[model samples]
Target: MTRLLIKNGAFITMDEEQLQFQGWMAIEGSRIAGLGAGAAPEQEISQASEIMDGKGMLFMPGLVNTHGHAAMSLLRGMADDLALQEWLQNHMWPAEAKFTGDDVYWGSSLAAAEMIKSGTTTFVDMYDHMHRVAEVTEQSGLRASLTRGVIGLCSEEEQKTKLAEAIQFARDWHGAAEGRINVMISPHAPYTCPPDYILKFVEAAHDLDLPMHTHMSETLAEVEQNVRDYGYRPVEHLDRLGMFSRPTLLAHAVHLKDEEIALLAERKVAVSHNPVSNLKLASGVARVPELLQAGVTVSLGTDSAASNNNLDLFQEITMAALLHKGVSGDPTVIPAAEALRMGTVYGARSIGHGGVTGQLKAGLKADFIAISLNKPHFVPYTDYISHLAYTARGSDVAHVWVDGRQLLRHGQLLTLDEERILAEAERCYQRLRG
Candidate 1:
């Protein structure tokens, strides 16, 4: 196993105390072996096969995106400023229906490129033709949790086939890609999937020992529709259907009530807060402060490039930090360290990968990014964590590593061919346009 060392960098260990110190980190193969402030011992430094100068950079756990549709990168900016139902029905779904496996491949490749460049080392993707997404993830060198999102608006036969695909995808891909890729069972959303249909996904999750992911309570209309159709609110309806029983990661969750928040807390369900997409779609803001206070693990997600126009989790973390403060009229809401955690620590827990890749601690997988701190914006680095949550953009990412392999070094991607990804993505876009 190759040994790597990062020296002379400021490290943010998002542990319980949210500690920050200028330090060095030692890595053996895929796991972190040692890290500390100041110079590492001569023995530790001598043991490294490769040594990197982390000077003038800040090292932190890479941003974790808990919800997204990687193949929707091609649909970005095609439809904007529309409500959820109208947007999905009139614009997004119609465009998606024309997507082929090749389209999924190129689109996912493009998204993976963007995500790596933007310092997102981990992400969750849900969409059709997910095998292509998995293919892109394998080449991109990013850790991911993936699922085939099933919308049950089709006929029984189609639904049966979709369920089979979801099951097969889960079975074939879970723990694949050197344990960097994970699979989940997704049934789209409450409004699109019937109770029986959603139950099938839950059953498949149980059978496969995988987690469940889905859109839930994204809009007030969705919640009301669930109440009208199922005689209960979305939270209760889904709980009754046994979705909360398994390890579940819910997307959006923007329209949850106070009691619903408590129930989610009690059930230990994780919420992927897609603030940018929710705001763009005019969906109400999630009660993030309430959720956090109620002990719910709330993480960050960009939804999809189609809705968010980008997959920058730094933006999502900033939005989560600022939006809650603005909405609640409490400046103390979602402090910087907590907001950073929303995209890292809480995110790993949300995806059921806690203690594996979230924090900069020994024995954890080496999933982290280095941001250039030599810029003028970082002149007064009174607080590096605050700067990360408030001032830094994804473009500031200098290097990224996942599972001890460097994917982006000095702002250049090592694993993926960027030129080819962009060209094929354009080709797919032109085909879709025609």
Candidate 2:
């Protein structure tokens, strides 16, 4: 196994202690071997096969996006400034119906390139043609939890086919890509999926023993519709249908009530707060402070480029930190450290990768990024966490590594062909439109 040592770098270890120190970190194979404050020991320096200069760099765990539709990169700005239902039914669904596997591959490739350059090493993607997305994940060297999101609004046979597809995707790809990829069973949302259809997914999840992901309570109208149809709120409706029985990650989770928040905490459910997408679609803000207070794991996500107009998790981090303070009028509600953790460690936990990545600790996957700290936004560096939460942008990411492999170095992608992806993505979009 090759050993690499990086010394004289500032590290934000989002470990159990929330430790930040100027230190040297040792990497063996694909996992972090050791890291500590101050100088590297003589033995480690002598034994290292590669030594990297870490001067003027700030290293931290790569951001984890808990919810997104990666293949929707092609749909960026296609139908923005619309409500969720109109956006999905009239524009998104019709456009997606025309998407072939090749389209998904190119779109996902484009999204992967954007995410890597933006410092997101891990993400949870719920979309169709997931095998293409998985192919992108394998090629891009990004860690991901991929799901075949099924909407049961079609005929009975179509619904079964969709469910079967979702099941087969989970079976075929769960633990692929050297354990960098995992699978989940995802129903599109409560409004799109009937109770019986959702229960089928729940059963399939139990049979496969896989976690589930879904869109839940994203808008107030959806909540009212659930009540009109099922006499229960979205949370109670999903809970009644055995969705909360399995480990699940719910996207948006805006428009949740107090009881719904309590129930989510009791069920140990995780919420992926898509603040930008919610706000863009005129969806109300989630009760994040209350959710955190109730012990629900809250993580950040950019729903999709189509909706958010970008795949920048740094923007999501800043939005999550600032949105809550302004909405609740509590200046100290989500502090810088907490917002940063939500983007990294809490995101890992939400997507069921907590045991392996999300922190710069020994015995964990070497998934992290380095930002050039000499930039003006990072100037004065009084509080690194504050700078990261409030001022940092995705363009500041200078290098990225996942699973001990250098994917981006010196602001250049090492594994992916960014130019080709950009060109092909444009071609794919034109084809879809035509």
Candidate 3:
């Protein structure tokens, strides 16, 4: 097995107790073999052909973007400052209709470059043409869970065909790319998918043992529509159809009611909180602290660059930590350490990789990021946890690893051509505009 060692860094594991120290993590093949303070295991260290000196840097589990449309990087900033309906109907959907496999590949590749540089090793993506997105993720050496965003506004036959395509894609690519990629079934949203269609998806997911990803109550307008049409809230309608019983990931759960929150907690539903996207689109803020207190697993996400304007999980983490407190009028709502957990370990849990890839522990996947704390903003590191949550930026990430492979080293992307990807994305965007 190929071995690697990361030594002498201030390690923040984001474990149950939030452990921190200057330590070494040993990687044997794609798994973390051991981690501790001071010295590495001699056998593991000796076997390492590559060593990463982590002095003046903070090593933690890589950020997990729990929800996003990776290919939407091609449409980023195209329809900003608009309501969600207008953004999607008038701008995004029309632009997406022009997307080809090549567009998905190039756009997803660009998104991968941006995410890796920003210290996100794992992301959950919902988009069309995900085969191209999967190929891009494989080539970039990033871990991902991908879903084909299924909108069932068409006929039942067309919906079945798309669902079959999504299922086939999952069967062929789930656990592919050296086990760095997984697959999920995504129903776009309640407004887009009728209850019967969602139930069909739920049954299919149950049959295939795949997780379901979907948007729920992203906006008040959406909630009002659901109420007007279905006579119940979004989550209530989903619960009525028994969609919440499955291993479900709910995105942008902004307008959830108290009863819906309880339902989520009871069903152990996972939520992806996209703070920046919510704020940008004028969507209401998610009750993250309430959800957390309700025993719901709340993870952090950037949604998509098109909606969020950037795929920076660090910024999301900071926003998630501060937004709830300010909105709830409580200073002790979400602590810095807890916010970090939402981005790292909790995110992994949301995507069904809980014990495997979230933390830097033995038997976990060696997927982590290193942020340089030697900068002015990170100076006087009186509290390492505080520095990580508040002081560190995406630019401070000097290294990133996924599945024991070095994808980013010393602020450089090893698997992607940054300039080419960006230029190709720009070209595609111009074509879409034209």
Candidate 4:
């Protein structure tokens, strides 16, 4: 029966018709109870147990990062300026081999702190030692979709063991953490996972009734390698392998053709577009404009801090908005509103949440962020959507709420100890370096 009210503010519902109103929102428990323009219902305000003054703030749905490796925050800036294969093998993979569960816990703690303070309430994470990741997700109060990313480039016995672990993790953690955490089956990528091993993961996902997440067509080299090894591109190869038969989210898809895009749209597969990470890795830009035109669900992802150096969806949204225009040389491509949707509601849909949490409407989860519009950059707010896409940075976020709980307020964390997390992550990094 706990009721929270937010009033006297500028609210962007991001709902159908893309409404903007100067109004308030009421939260009854974890779901939004009411939202409107002008004045709120007197009875709703009177029943509120907690009231937050939203004056001078633009309240909108909390940002959703559809794909990331959360624990890789510990390796941020450690392996930069390298292509995919060299970076993964020479730098990331070797360092990751020495990691223990405690390392993952601390790293994930640090990552959660960064994300919460920056206004990302929900994110999809794929990495190893995911039990520790789940523990942190529960304690941090941030909603997350987590998976044990398996690379099946090992002995047959080793591959079997990894599959068992992935299944066990899916069994124990699906819809866990009071439903704040969701579990997904992840076969790291087409190149890393052989066809048979990936089929086993697909089978597990089907049995568990959960969706799948994986990297696909991230780079030209990877696509060429897929063709060389499998005699077909990843999209067709995976479709042939029955991956598209299940609900799947594919990360990257930077190298795609029109027919491939059409196939993905037909199969109802979603894509996670990591603009900054792809540019940094020289992975090339995704055919986002074409994909969206084909009615394919294209959402935003930051990949990992190690590559992009930050888990800021604002940056990704901005990149998606501007990069497409510059590359396509068309001003009308990926408008600000559409870019914002990709980072928020579209991202929620990609991770299987959709309208349940990514909008400011009644009955949706009370997962939204409040950004202070009092800054100089935000002055003359001719268009809030444009400001959010082109001018806003993560630091402008003043508050974040997920599932009716405040995780960050006044740019500080409420559910986690930031200093301790920073110290522990630093210690872990020191150990890794030593």
The candidate scoring highest on lDDT is 2
Give the whole-model CA lDDT for all candidates, comma-separated: 0.92, 0.93, 0.90, 0.92
lDDT of 3 by residue, 230-326 (tens): 9998988888887877889999999977988998999889999999999999998998988999999999999889999999899998998889889
Q: Model 4: how far is 38 from its true place, Å?
A: 0.4
TM-score: which is higher, 3 or 4?
4
TM-scores for all predictions = 0.99, 0.99, 0.97, 0.99
Colliding pairs, model 3: none
Candidate 1 lDDT by residue in tens digits, 329-351: 99999999999999999999999
* Candidate 2 residue pairs in backbone clash: none
Residue-level error in angstroms, candidate 1, position 278: 0.6
For candidate 4, lDDT tens digit of each residue in 1-434?
88988889999888976478898899888889988888768887889898888889999999999999988899999989999999999999999999999999999999999999888999999999999999999999999999999999999999998889888988888888889999999999999999988899989989999899999999899999999999999999999988998999999999998899999999999999999999999999999999999998989999999999999889999999999999999999999999999988898998889878888898999999999999999989799989999999999999999998889889989999998999999999999877
**Residue 45 C-alpha lDDT in model 1:** 84
Model 4 Cα shift for residue 27 (angstroms): 0.6
Weakest 10 consecutive residues, lDDT, candidate 1? 11-20
lDDT score, candidate 1: 0.92
